[model samples]
Target chain A: MFRYIVRRLLQGVLTFFGATFVVYCLMFAGGGDPIQALAGEKPVTAQQRAALTEQFHLDDNFFARYLYFLKDFFTGNLKSYTGRDVFENVGSALQLTGKIALIAIIFTIVVGVTLGIVAALRRGGIFDTSSLILTLVVIGIPSIVLAPLAQYLFGIQWKIFPVNYTFEKPFVSLILPGLVLGTLSLATAMRLTRASFFDNLRADYVRTATSKGLTRFRVVGVHVLRNSLIPIITFLGVELGNLMGGAIITEGVFNIPGIGGQLYKAIGLDDGPTVITFVSLLVVIYIVANLVVDLLYAVLDPRIRYE
Target chain B: MNEHLLEVDNLFIEFHTRDGVSKVINGVSYHLNAGETLAVLGESGSGKSVTAQAIMGILDMPPGKITRGRILYRGRDLLTMSKEERRKVRGEEIAMVFQDALSSLNPVFTVGNQISETLRKRKGMSKADAMKRAVELMDQVKIPGAKERVKDYPHQFSGGMRQRVMIAMSLAMDPKVLIADEPTTALDVTVQAQIMDLLAELRRDLNMAMILITHDLGVVADVADRIAVMYAGRIVEHADVHALYKNPAHPYTKGLLESIPRLDAKGTELATIKGLPPNLLRPPTGCAFHPRCKYAQDICVTTTPPLLDLGGGRTSACHFAKELLDGRI
Candidate 1:
């Protein structure tokens, strides 16, 4: 198991490098002049252009710039294109996004799995049908639509919560939009849990448990639920990564001072360095989340071994 | 004689499909005595497993229903019993071990926990006591290192070992009757022999009546006291094991016996039963097996034959039982 974990960790590191390299290539090779975007659309002389190129290290070849980026990225010396320290500006935003995403994931799993089990146990009944219909409706509506609706209902109409921009009280700001972002995931998790649990209910082991004269609760709980959670866990892990990447719209709607909001501001100002830094950070988080999921696979199922 | 431990008289089961309600087990009747083994033998999809499931009270309700039946155990009709009462009688009075041992045991649980849970629930034993008894049951089934290896999950054990775990679990409650449904079909030949031997020994030690359900005639030859050959959800032939093997009165039984590959017939083509069992949804108008019977006559196609007593407690459901007895067919 230790060997398996170490091997997975190494693979994760390699995967992170591959992802970062893609982001780096896209930023550099793609036809976009960061200097012009930062400086504006005004006409400039050749000497001024050369000076801006030198300042941003664009004068060097692709390989040299890549090497420098890699060295600084590893040494914690990341700097934005506007000459601001990237680590100080972007790092804290990444941390805040991580916390919100983590909380949303936890809430989604607990509530989603509970509703799923309830629906499955009462299959074809009112509770099951209602839960299924509700999930479908929630998943059909995009977060872009749900976020404004949430803000309108909870913030503007009811006046029960703050309207926007609550960095000082992050938890208060997190509620409305976090819930808006989490709704689709909660629905997805519930659907997955229901399908997996029902599949397990039809398995022969469950029948065997029943034949042993086990109570219905024990049969469903110990035999059916544990085996069913395998697929649900896998899907939840992927959903966690998606939530981390996709919370931008929700953050923008509520104006939360997280990576998502920062990303929006950077994109509006066309700040290429800040965009690359934040997106690369997200890629790293996604890769690490997947790594943790792989590790959990071995833990949840004894049949899976690292070696 | 200890009287009948279980009696099923005129049991009828039906399945509801998109087409209509189709009868599967049509008025099948049988009974089991205490401390005796009755082997129910048939081809696949002959409603053998469904009958077993009905008796265990585990049949899926919406699709499957006991349309008409009387399943009497200890003089109480189990069909009319409350759910709780039936559940209480299921593992405590009558336990079942299913086919496909690997799939039958819960994969996530330890063998010891699965066995001990039944013991604790039915026998009212504490955890430590149940574990001790579970180990003993494991030792009885010849699972090596029962004390230490009890914590192993189902996948950790081999097919034969998993079957042994299943047997140990069934025997945990000291049930009066044990039903093993094709228990050895998933095993290799050598392991099949070992499981059959272990079952025979356990049956003798526990002195419990057993219902051994299998399609293999050779398997039940040594273990079963009485053999009931089922065809198309009906018992076509019933007799003592020696009598049935020595002289099969029904055509389906004869075909089944001749189909078994034997070393004595080296270099000779094995006898094969022609055609499959009739689809229960639209079975033949008269006898279900007439379409597949070599000696099926006009009367066999137009009218169903009743199970007739041919003296000496033997019965055969065939139009030409006399012809078979007289070697006229």
Candidate 2:
């Protein structure tokens, strides 16, 4: 298992370089003067331009510039186009994003999996039909639409929640944004869970478990749930990276200071350091999530040993 | 015993499908006595397994409704009992080993975990104690290197070994009545005999009453004390194994016997029943076997024959059962 993890990490490093290189090439492909893009109609002196150019290595070749970007990231000297410290921005934003993402994951797994199991066990009943319709409506509405609506309805009209996120009560403040951010994924996970649970409930082994005089709880909880989770785990693992990336719209509406919002502005201003740093971290998240999912598959299914 | 160990009386179960209700088990009734092995012989969809499922209280309720009859275990009607009461009787008093061992055993769990889980839950043994007993049960089923193999999952075992694991799992509860639903159906020919022998030997050693459900006559011919032949969810014939094989009183039973290939009849076209088994959905009028039975007559088409007692513990569900017995049909 240790060897497997080490091998995967090595592969992850290669993937990291490959992904960032492609994104770097695409960002550079935007072309024209980098200083002008950053200045955005502001009057710039030749002296200031020369100083900034020298500082940011605007004259360097593509490979040299890429190396410098990597060096600046590792050495913690990376800065945004606005002269703000990219590392500090990314770090603090990541922490906030992480909190929301964690809450979103919890909301998705708990509500999604529970509704799925209940709906599957009582398939074709009222609850099942309603769950089907509910998930469908939620999945149909993207976070862009839901976030603002939820903010207005629950936050302002109902007064159930604060209109803006407050760090005083992080959990309380993040709950609404988390639910909004996880809406699509939660709906998706519910549908997948329902289908998987339905199929596994009808499996032959479930019958065997029943014949063995196991209680309903053990049968569904331990036996059926173990089998049902394979597909859910796969979906959630792949969605982990998207939770943060997809947080942009949620964070924007709720005024939650997170990397998603930072990444958005950086991309708009063609801020190389901030974009590269944030996106590289997302790449890392994807790699780790995939590895964890793969490892979890082995745990769930004995037939799939790492060896 | 005052009453049989397990008795399934006038049991009727139907499948409510979109295509309409399929009358699966049409008044099927049979019983098992202490230390007796009663083999239920039938083709697919004959409701042999469904009857066993109903007895075990594990039948899929909506699709499979037991509209009539009682499954009495030790003089108590299981159907009438409370869910909690019936659950106590299922694994503790009556256990079942299903066909397709690979699918029947939970895939993700170790063989030991699956076995010990039941021991822990029903028997209420500690994990360590239950696990040790699980290893013993594995060894009892003749699985080599039981202690080491107990940690292995179902997929790790070969077809025969997997079936053995399933048998071991069922035997763990020390159930008085072990209902093996086509246990060897998924195994190879050579392994089929081994599994049947292992089951028979275990039954004798444990002195447990067994209901061996099988399609192949050759598989149960030696192990079975009596054979109950099912046709379209009803028992067409029930008799001692020797008497039924020597002279079957029902045409369906006779047809099944002829289907079995004999060594002396080599190079000749293997005898097969001319037509297919009747479909339970919209089955033929009156006698279900009329379409498939060679001795089917006018009366056979108009009236379903009751399972007539032919004395000497023999019964046949054919209109001309006596004539067939007398060799006059």
Q: Which number leads on lDDT?
A: 2
Model 1 Cα displacement at B180 (Å)? 0.6
As a whole number from 0 to 100, the lDDT of residue B176 in candidate 2 is: 95
Query: Model 2 TM-score?
Result: 0.97
Docking class of 1: medium
Best by DockQ: 2
Measured against the native two-chain assembly using Cα atoms, what DockQ does each of the candidate structures obtain, in the order listed? Answer: 0.58, 0.86
Model 1 C-alpha lDDT per residue in residues B119-141, reported as the tens digit of each score? 77767889999999999999999
Taking the candidates one at a time, how many backbone clashes does each contain?
0, 0
Worst 10 residues of 1 chain B by lDDT: B1-10
The lDDT for every candidate, in the order shown, is 0.85, 0.90
> How many residue pairs in model 1 have overlapping backbones?
0
The structural similarity of chain B in model 1 to the true chain B, as TM-score, is: 0.98
In angstroms, how far off is A82's CA in candidate 1? 4.1
